[model samples]
Target: MATLDESERYRILSDERRRLVLEILAERTTGIGLDDLAQAVTTRQTTGTDVGPGTVDRVRIALHHKHLPMLDESGVLSYESEVRQVEQPRVASERHA
Candidate 1:
């Protein structure tokens, strides 16, 4: 399991979109599909703003290339690249306790 330090945890939560990912994951009892997750994140990020087309794909790519890896490395989430699925790790919940 990935270890967590104060700096790392803070880093994981630092970005608004990344924080949104965590929030969405926490609500899901099952792993969330990448497309669904991207849609949810885009919805939150572009709620009152004029979002351009391909925003969801951009979010998906960013999550795949950056944010998800950060969360996985921080022990917060288990990201299955092959399936493009994400689930909150057990240690992540324990860390919150």
Candidate 2:
């Protein structure tokens, strides 16, 4: 796992979407699929708004192309890009501790 300096950690967590992703992952006991994660994020983000498939798709694409990779590289989470799965890394628990 890679080490993140304070500035890097702040940068990674600065985005509302990424913070939401971490929050969701913290509540899960197992890995979440990219599709499911996207839906969850979209639902949380758009609380009362009428959400469309396009909205979810846009979120999914951003997560896949940007956020997930950033989190994975920061050792904050484990992202299996090929399988489109996201899991909180074991090291993340220790880091938090």
Which one is best on TM-score?
Answer: 2
Q: Which regions of candidate 2 are displaced past 4 Å? A: 1-3, 92-97
lDDT (Cα, tens digit) per residue for candidate 2, span 1-97: 5688999989998999999999999899999999999999999999999999999999999999999999998888999999999987876467688
1-97 per-residue lDDT for model 1 (tens digits): 5677888878777899899998998788888988899889999988898766588889999999998887887767888888998887866467689
Q: What ranges in model 1 sit over 4 Å off?
A: 1-3, 50-53, 91-97
Error of 2 at 76 (Å): 0.2
* Model 1: per-residue Cα lDDT at residue 53: 57
